[model samples]
Target: MKYRFALNNDIPNLVRLINNAYRNNIDKSWTNETQYVSGSRITQDQLFEELNKPGFLLMVIEGPDTRSKQLIACIGITFYETYAEIGTFCIDPSFQQAGIGKTLLGRAEQFLQIYNSNIKAINMYVLNVREELIQYYERRGYKKTGLIEDYPLDANLGMPLLDLNLIEMQKTLI
Candidate 1:
């Protein structure tokens, strides 16, 4: 597999991959959010806007072979003054539980630290109900900050099936 920055042409595939990983009921994974949320995870237009942002990056893991390379996982990072925010992280359901997500996350952290010398920590938020996801990150050294952000109901990303809040987690780079 190859880890690389997403290109403009990658938006469509990225959109499908993200939505499936997050909202598809047929292919449920531990990370699936369909139980707590409904609707598309991301739209192409929104991704385009984010892609053009100055301090943002979307990384993907493509694989099998060069001739038929397919995106199996992705993560986005937004650089800040002293830290970076990780978001839109997903892996194709078939690829989960195979150590791919772990590797991709580690690489993303390493990439940010190498790409920007100023980043001292990495932050990400998980839905408060996603205990499995929260614990997964905790195992990787992220700590819950006890900061909760209200879920944006008007964001068009999805409609929450339950009252939800985003729980902030952070990992300080050493």
Candidate 2:
């Protein structure tokens, strides 16, 4: 098991991992209604643009399967001076319940620690409607910050739902 930052060429697998984690997985917090209504798709071009942005880190976990290549998990981070935002943190559903998601969260936290000396917090915004997801994060030591906001309608997130509220979760690294 090797852990490394993603390369420019890994965007395709990264996108697949994320989309599968939620929009496609049966046990995922995101249901068919959510994926269907949202049109959940991200193109390689968009991923490239996102990757080139400042303070964005894309990390992937890979290992050999007997028959083929596989993407086990991934996490993306957008860092700021005082804090960092975590997005698209997911493990393949096939790899779920195997501690891959926990490992990815640890990596995300480690990445955040590199920027701010105090590393006041690692933050994320999850769909407010995804109760199971929120509970998952809570179990991982992230507490609700009571900050809820809507996803941008024109944010190029494949497709947008009519109304979406995301609740913020924060974990203090120090």
Candidate 3:
């Protein structure tokens, strides 16, 4: 597997991956409802802008088989002085349960280390109700801080959503 910064052309594939990561969370199994019912998606423009931000780092894991380096996995991060936030992280479902996610997370942490030596932890908000996913991260060294965060939703629509409430999880890396 190879990893590199995401460029504008990778946005489409990245968006599809993000959607697929959350698409199954409709009314079926208690996930993001507000986005599910509607055709909510992370637009390419949004991604392009985010990637252009000063402290943002979006890395794409490219498969070795393809010369174009299709983005099979991604980890989005935002650095804020002393700490960083794990905004969006997803691997193609085909790559799920593999160590790709962990490797991606590690890469993000490594990136954070450069901006601040005090980069003591990386923060992520997981679905408060998605126990399995929360557990997945927990097993990878993240811990719940007992803090609950409100998951943002566009009030105009009613869609199936699960991670509406976010639980703060942090992993110390410094």
Candidate 4:
């Protein structure tokens, strides 16, 4: 597996991968969101805008599966002066449970460390309803920061089957 920042040409496939892992209900058992959401997690336009943001690193993980070396996973991180926030993290459902998500996260942390030695923490938000996902992050050393945010209706994330909120999680890297 190879990890690198996504290029301009990677947006479409990235959109597909994220939606398949987050919103699509077609045999995607890795995420709990599928049971609650029924639309694409992100659109190409949104992803393009995210990629162009300052201090935002959209990373893609490519595999040697196909002849073209297709991307199988991805994540987005926005760096602040002394910390960073991670989002848009997903692995293709077909590639889930194979440790790809964990590996991508590990590599991303390492890369961020190299890029910003002053970074003291890595933060992210998990759907409060997704207990399993929260546990996963907790097992990886993230602790809740006592912050909760309402799911945005205009974010185009999806149509929620139930009320949802995002809870903050952070891991101190320093």
Number of the top TM-score candidate: 1
lDDT of each: 0.90, 0.73, 0.73, 0.86
Ranking by TM-score: 1, 4, 2, 3
Better of 2 and 3 by TM-score: 2
Model 3 pairs in collision: 31-161, 31-162, 32-160, 32-161, 32-162, 33-159, 33-160, 33-161, 34-159
TM-score of 1: 0.96
After the best TM-score superposition of candidate 4, give how far the Cα of residue 72 lies from its true spot, in angstroms: 0.3
Distance from true location, Cα of 130 in model 4, Å: 0.5
Residues 38-128 of candidate 1 have per-residue lDDT tens digits of: 8888899999999999999999999766576688899999999999999999999988889999999999999988998889999999999
Order by lDDT, highest first? 1, 4, 2, 3
Predicted candidate 3 versus true structure: per-residue lDDT over 138-172, tens digit per residue? 98888998999665566322344443677899888
Q: Among all windows of ten consecutive residues in candidate 2, which has the lowest summed lDDT?
A: 28-37
Full-model lDDT, candidate 1 = 0.90
lDDT over C-alpha atoms for residue 72 of model 4: 87
Kindly list the per-residue Cα lDDT of model 2 for residues 58-157, writing each as its tens digit.
Answer: 7777854723446777778888877888887777777677777788788778767875675578899887767878898899899999998877557666
Tens digit of per-residue lDDT, candidate 4, span 43-134? 99999998998899898989766567688888899999999999999888777889988988898898889988989999999889888889
Tell me the deviation in Å of residue 96 in model 3: 1.9
> Which residue ranges in model 1 land beyond 4 Å of their true spot?
25-27
Per-candidate TM equals 0.96, 0.85, 0.81, 0.94
| Candidate 2 Cα errors over 4 Å, as ranges | 27-37, 66-69, 114-118, 160-162
